[model samples]
Target: MAEVHSRSSHRELRVQAGASDNVTANELFDIEEQRNRLSRMFCFDGMGGALLIEPSFPGCGMIDAGKGDLIYSNALYEIKAGDRLFRSVDVRQLITYSALNYVSKRFQIDSLGLFNPRVGVSATIPVDDLCAEISGKQSSDLFFDIVAAISSGDISR
Candidate 1:
């Protein structure tokens, strides 16, 4: 179980679990605190409008997309807290978010990036290059299929 505590402008979510567990309660608490700290760091007022934390995208359901982690003025950032190396799936996710942003015309996604603070590594791809790569892989059809399924609400097949 988890207990949420709110004090002033700070919020903490504490999970209670045994020490022997694979992920102990203290670990969960630490993770939540780190996330909150990162959120604060990327917050608009704190970052001088450089980044917006967890900005919502309207009509994301049309493409089965979710809110992105952070949004820079000209790009979208997906933060991976763990030390895991960046993968193709991560690139695909950012590309999909870029595509959705393009279609929505809310924010023109100039670039996409994967940031891993744990390892202090980052990779960025220009939206045009990403789109070209997806096209070269012939994956655009699959992406469109997903959008079609979501729009029709008949993903079952």
Candidate 2:
């Protein structure tokens, strides 16, 4: 079993192309939803060592509008690994994943909450594994093997 780490449940926010009368065009506001894949999260392990996963995991995400305004955004998520909130295992995964997956692909991140002070990053792993590692029942070595296959020589960079 995976070790239980810190956990701080946060609300997921999604900004639509057009702003409503209640909210200003550039003003930040809070809204609630049960769950949205665009802003959903998954963990690799039990907060021990994990990464954050969203719709644009392998790409820097953006919300484009027909007008001149180009809305760029990324999901704000917090992971709880250990005593540290947002600066532990998940941090490396976020940096590694973002670098290897999105940055390597030339995806742009409008803003990041990985190590922001404003947001409380819970260092706990989510129940799901976006990579399907759990269901596959593959050991760590096997998982790395799969990663090796998927990444090939590109992962070295």
Candidate 3:
């Protein structure tokens, strides 16, 4: 999934993904080893829910059109293969995607989630709860503020 990382930051990943040796290739095999388990961890009820991989939502202001890791059922789960637990960047990524979806009205995103296969851990929170916990604002108000801020040229990048 394309999180908010710069191109240069993925140079090593590009090399790792394309590495010629067997050991390195096996070392970078996240999909082969982690996909099903991580999806399950994200509560991706293999049969019941709609599973969308790399979903793109309508952009707002400078956000542009962006694709998230995936959305299973109604929850948007940001999949991370990092060595540790959830990070701030992970939460920001979900919030940014949610804000984008907030304006897009693409689908009913009732919950937000973070999953790390590397740590075998996952966390999910309802949309309003996440917004309230982060900013003490309802999701609608928080999303409106973000759109207004970006549209008003408040952010440089």
lDDT of 1: 0.61
> Relative to the unseen true structure, what is the C-alpha lDDT of residue 6 in candidate 1, on a scale of 0 to 100?
24
Span of 10 residues, lowest total lDDT, candidate 3: 4-13
Local accuracy of candidate 3 as per-residue lDDT tens digits, 1-157:
4333222222221334554555565566664457556545533443456566688877888888888887766889888888888889889888888888888798789999988776678898999999999999999999998888878886889
- Please count the clashing residue pairs in each candidate, in the order shown: 0, 6, 0
lDDT of 1 by residue, 37-154 (tens): 5545444224344555575565545465468877665668888877588888888777676656655776656777887755556777776666667675333454455456556755
Model 3 ranges with Cα > 4 A deviation: 1-21, 24-32, 42-47
Which portions of model 1 miss their true places by more than 4 Å? Answer: 1-49, 60-65, 137-154
TM-score of each: 0.58, 0.26, 0.77
Ranking by TM-score: 3, 1, 2
Q: What value does the lDDT take at residue 73 in candidate 3?
A: 62
State the C-alpha lDDT per candidate.
Answer: 0.61, 0.34, 0.75
For model 1, give the 10-residue run with minimal summed lDDT: 1-10
Best by TM-score: 3
**Between which residue pairs do clashes occur in model 2?**
79-122, 79-123, 80-122, 80-123, 80-124, 81-123
| Candidate 1 to truth, TM | 0.58
Top candidate when judged by lDDT against the true structure: 3
lDDT, candidate 2, at 35 = 26
In candidate 2, what are the lDDT values of residues 85-120, reduced to their tens digit?
444455445433433333343334333334322242
User: Any residue pairs clashing in model 3, and if so which?
Assistant: none
| Model 1 per-residue lDDT at 141 | 54
Q: Any idea what lDDT model 2 has?
A: 0.34
